[model samples]
Target: MSALTAPHLNRWLIRLHRPALFVWTVVLLGLGSALMCLWGPLADASAEAWQQHYACAPTGPCLYDQAAILRYKHIYDYATMAVLAVPFLVAAWTGAALIGRELEQRTAQLAWTQGLTPTRWLLSKLTLPAALVTAGTGLLVLLHHGMWWASEGRIGSAKSWYDPPTFYAGGPITVALALAGLFAGAFAGVLLRRSLAALGAAVVAVGALWAGVHQALPHLWTPVTGVSSLESDLPVGNGVDVSTGLLTADGERLPDPFCGSTINPQCERLYDRLGAVSWYHDYHPLSHYWPLQLTASAIVLAVAALLALAAFRVTAVRTRGLS
Candidate 1:
């Protein structure tokens, strides 16, 4: 028993220290650093713009610019996409290589004969890669937080940071999803025994899973809502008027008028004649975010585990036949 366990532990250690793992670490750190550096400049620009248009007073006539908020939203959307793509690509590449190459090169036979238990062997193979992925993703989350902090106080009239899907960004859910993809890819390699084919299968499988889960599930566990206060000239008398809204403790929308021409023809005819209008809107979730993410990831991981177990059984059977 001791001998068997020793060999298994050694294999795990060797796999963990592989060059590929180091490369993954470096790549993630580099990407995170680059993104973090960009936050300062973006925040500065946003702050400068805010100072120009909006008055920061304790109590007075204040307005939110919808157009500027939209512009920021657009920029953040693209930035987030680029940030997320890195983890997904890394997970896919690493996962495909995890078990695929071993089977392709027929190395599993020798490794099994070296007195390693199948469970330990499989765990060893997965441990380092999984850790690497988790660490990288954690760094990404940190970078996201930094950017969020930098932009927080600056954007007064903008939408809620959580409004855009990009703002949901990469969190625990995303890390779990990427890890599930890796597991699925590795399982594909076990079943297919060909690197390229396993990679293709993994891609298709993950894509389908992501699409299905995202569509079927709504924001329940992770409530993603965008809240923004916009102050624009309400169209009154061939011109625009200004308005504002308030939110109740229960998140109910309440309008509060500040100033506007009541007698203006456009204000009476088009602007609802309520002067400046203030109101709040709430976006309710159709479903939970965390539970669905977890469930979907679990399903993929279960499938991967089953596939690995099947591969182990097949290999053991073949060994017995030769004996």
Candidate 2:
């Protein structure tokens, strides 16, 4: 049999998945356009509305372009959600269409029999899709970041940089998550060999992975501690809160009594009884954003590599007899 080169295999893979390609392209273009609109016109309109709102008299009825502000907020929310959903979409498509369907239809087997090794077939299936997913996801993420940055401090309702959804959608971490979802779906497809089952498993796997990352993110970096006297309000600031509690005279951290400030006579008495001297906040500042994002992304990419390795191993085992 004549050798099936990489270009030939890639052409066949693209032909087989043309519909999926069209859908992905449409999604990218539509979302990118929305984000660009948000970054420029939508943000500017919302900012002007907020300026008008601030100009209104304190004690009199005033009118502002509420619709423009609400529209900007709604569009930003919807766009952020769409950016975050890319991973799940990639997971489902990779498992069901890219890998699982091919295996289920015996197309993979045919390729393996036609002078194409199972490993080469699997690589061909993944390579183009990974490249496309990365580029598309990265573009969306960059646009989301630009939109958020443009609205920052201008629109009153804009989500903060530290907001979880905004943070995920506006960084390279989303790109990592997309790639991880790709490998996870590929792993599920190779393991299950059924399109529907693989699709569910892949989505669930990505969900679980994201949950794990969310839970562990704050602890991934050492947090800055803010301390304040009991006479002051809580030491919490505009940052990601990891922990907030009371500190003893000896600096021992203790659970917060949830009482009001020491100016409140009743709360002061309670704090005296509890031997609480001050409030302490352990949190990540905005300065830590890049470090946290890079750290989390590295962890996700490592997991993706493992998943890819497992997919290849499973494929080898399944096709060993044919070889």
Candidate 3:
């Protein structure tokens, strides 16, 4: 039999996954609606409450609706969490439904026996899922960025651009991360060939990768170091601080001088004695955000490519009879 063309393979894959595809479509539509709602009415409410919070002045002694301000913060945090959780959900689904269940049920053998090479079978499995995952996650991140920016300068907004969730969920890095999760999950499924086990392990693997990225993120870009007077607050630029503290008179870095309070006489003496601190700090500035994010995304996508290669290699070798 002639080898099946890519279009035929894609059609077969879609037919096989019609149920899953339908569910995902419904889920995405619901999420998209929620995102639009957040951008409109939610944003309006949050902005109003935030303005009220800042309107209070010492001379005016005004009272603001604390509940409304708190509600805005809660909505922002939870919405961010929902977007950030996409990778984990993709990883679990990939490990279980995409590959593991196929292996566990031995249905993959039917495709191979039908003159479909193992390589083609595996490629078909990964390609459609990868495209759908990348597109879905990309859309979510784009929506997240819109919502994040809407509340950014608002007084009561609790989200920080440099926070781990916000940083990864609000940029192109998010698409790269979702791809990584898919590849990692596919690898686990092929290796373990047990649906439940692969699902659990795939999630764990993705979580570990996420943690590693967060820890190494600051170092991904070279940091700027600077010094200032002891009296000045730590310089917070567009970027987040990797490390920051006061320096002694002799250029030695000191632990933060928790001198109790600025009003305390002792606190004043110690701060003054610290004597013109070269307030040293290492940080990625706002300008560094994209560079660092893109660098990290490239690394993650490279790793995902490697994982894909490995999956193809293993699938072909183990089912060499079909090859």
Q: Which number leads on lDDT? A: 2
1 against 3, candidate with superior lDDT:
3
Error of 1 at 212 (Å): 2.0
Residue-level lDDT tens digits of model 3 in 144-258: 7787777677646656788878888788777887888888888888888988988998889878888888788888888997666545555344466778777777777776765
How does candidate 2 fare on TM-score?
Answer: 0.97
Give TM-scores for every candidate, taking all chains together and pairing residue i with residue i. 0.60, 0.97, 0.87
Report the error of model 3 at residue 286, Å.
1.7
Report the lDDT tens digits of candidate 1 across residue range 78-118.
Answer: 65675666535644564456777776886654566667655
Q: Top TM-score: which candidate number? A: 2
Ranking by lDDT: 2, 3, 1
Better of 1 and 3 by TM-score: 3
Clashes of each: 20, 0, 1
- Residue 248 CA error for candidate 1 (Å)? 25
Candidate 3 C-alpha error for residue 228, in Å: 2.6
Per-residue error for 8 in candidate 1, Å, reads 6.8
lDDT values for all models = 0.56, 0.92, 0.78
